[model samples]
Target chain A: MNDFEYLEPATVAEACAMLKRYGGEARPYAGGAYLSIVMKQGLIRPKALVNIKKIQELKGIRFDPSEGFVIGALATHRELETSQLIREKLPILCAVEREVANIRVRNVGTVGGNLASGEPLTDLAQVFLALDARVAISGPSGDRTIPLEELFVDLYQTSLGEEEILTRVIVPPPPPATGIEYIRFSSSSVVDKPCVGVAVRISLNADRKTCGTVRIALGCVAPRPMRAQGAEALLTGHPLSPQLVEQAAAAAAEECSPISDLRGSERFKRGIVRVLVRRAMAVAYDRASHASTLRLRSGQAGSA
Target chain B: MKKQIRLRVNGMDRTVEVAPRTSLLEAVRDQLGLTGAKLGCDMQVCGACTLLLDGKPVSACSFLAVDADGSELTTIEGLAAGDRLHPLQEAFMDCGALQCGYCTSGFILTAKALLDEQPRPSEEQIKDYLGGNFCRCGCYQEIIQAVKKVAGI
Candidate 1:
């Protein structure tokens, strides 16, 4: 850790002003888990750190069945994992959150910091991208919402400006009778770097035998989280037959451009993507089929 | 540049002047002369530097000393009361949960947080909660047993 001035800004306005005053010389600190490690590695060297943990505007989790879910920037992974609304509304997110490092890392790792770092291996990126989540960023000019896909321009790079602060993430609630699944293949026992991770959200029809709409996002198999548009198109408005699911999985694997890295070979990642996509789709379909049954049972219990 | 930071460590409030980049672990061990919080990997990978920041477990090695201004912190030293050892500490000893004892403090603090939140956590949940803190001595079986015994499960 190099010597740098630390300014604890109480408000987002003050923090933004400090960033504007210092420009690129200052960096905002959230959890400081990744930033500290990166600074030690000489990847980044800022003259000042704008501590934003005290900013009340950047914390909390709010969910509205009509308006969607809004998670504040400073909300930790542990917060999300334990959130009752998150567990009920988006259980797939809980599955991914549980796999992120561990309890200690999750306790301090914030959602905004994780996404702002734009790490390819981050689980939130793929999960949010699949859900069509939007990021709320506050810059000197003002605040703006950027879709998750547009936020990540490349590895370790995002559309965030030097003076900008990511405030919140807005994820629209999935439609009724919708289900989601996240699947990943880790290189090591502890899931350091994922070989390939897939997120699938699908809505089933009234009969619960056909898909109404589908969204599929793949991570660690591309420069940024990429949507398997062709695979999704094949699944949407079609019955999720075993043959169609296999074909969609193959299409997803064919569309990805994975590289041989320390995690796995390009071919190995492609294979994992194929298998994971199929498995995720199966689980998602099952959830979609049972959504009505689960809803009715819960409603009846509440009334009773 | 050295800045003045006031931190309440264990149960005492102490003010110290240190370099801006000095880690909390170094401040507690070197400056304040409290060596209970061990420094393993200077990075956040190892849980040897785990401590309570406002009742939450965090890697003190990754935390800056200046960040502790007006904050409450607790180390392994504070777990005991007077001359008596804490229940977890005693349980660790009774169950022989430590071999070499290098990672004991971090593990103890982490387990303290877990047992505080969940008085009786399942065996699998205990494993998940302690996933980040590593013990090379492979005394996890005994540690789990000790925690369970303390929880009266």
Candidate 2:
């Protein structure tokens, strides 16, 4: 934690200017939840921190009739956990966010900072990937929107440029009869980072008997959260049967590349991935089947 | 690189000049002389540095002191009125929710925020909210009792 200039920019344009001027010597300071720890360990020492907390444009979670959820990058995890709009459209996110890190971290950690940090042991990317989330970035060249998966490059790395600032996370509303579920496996304490996280989204056709579009996203099993394309290929446009689900789950277990760490062993992680993907897929399918009736009421959604 | 920031700490207006890297815990303890919030793990894992920022519990150890500018900060010292103890404090005392006391401030601050947000939270909710604060002495049973007693549940 070395001394550095703290610059607070009230607008995105100003923030981008400051970042461009500082070049690689500046970093956008968000909630400081993850950045503080890494900086304290001397992993990063930016000459100036472009504090983006005051930027009004990056601060709200709004719903667009056509585009669905336009979540501001500065929206804290606690805000998402308690947002009425999010609870209405994507209750699964609320449920998953309830178990993210802890109350303290959730109160200040922003969704944008979480994704921009490119930390692999996260739950949001997998869940967002299942929902087909995208991010908006502003830089010297201008603003551009890209899929969230593309933003992630490798360990603590993002495809974003040095001056690019991630501004918003856009999650299009789930299609009708679409159900998404994300399950996290913590090897030790509930507070521990996920050993393996599995997110499954299943959209059923009008018949409600077959999967129309399916997505399987796995986290903490690779350098970055990734889609289990092979596993997803097995279930898309097909009926989700016991045997089919088993095959897809097995394929997912074989697809992920996990290394041994304090959380769990590689084999154990794959085993957890298999179990979580299977369970999450089954849950998602059940919800998609009963999407209309099974949707949590606003009252129940507000509880967690 | 030191910058002056204003904070309404413990319901009192105060200002401190801190470097960008100075943590909220250090500022509160060293400059403000309110040391209820302790630096336990330094990482955000342990809640020993929990402080209520605008009534929301934040890890002061990881939160930048300068970022708390123009915000209301409540620590363990804020929970009492003169010599009178807050209800949660009384509940903790009556229920014997603490032993070594290293983790007491953090737990109490987090519990205060929880009770403030949800006056009557379920048992599961209590565990979920307080799950981050670790107690080596294992006074979890009494801690739950204290919170429930305060909630009158």
Write down the RMSD of all candidates, one decimal each: 4.1, 2.3
Per model, the share of native interface contacts recovered reads: 0.66, 0.96
Candidate 2 lDDT, tens digit per residue, A27-128?
A: 999999888988899999899999999999999999887776899999999899999888877788888889899999999999999999999998989989
- Model 1: per-residue lDDT, tens digit, A110-150? 99999998788767788888788999999889989889888
Query: Under CAPRI classification, how is model 1 graded?
Result: medium
Question: Which segments of candidate 1 are over 4 A away from where they belong?
Answer: A64-66, A191-193, A205-207, A293-304
Q: Evaluate residue A79 in candidate 2 and report its C-alpha lDDT on the 0 to 100 scale.
A: 92
Each model's DockQ score: 0.69, 0.90
Top candidate (lDDT): 2
* Per-model CA lDDT versus the true structure: 0.84, 0.89
* Chain A of candidate 2 compared with the true chain A, TM-score: 0.96
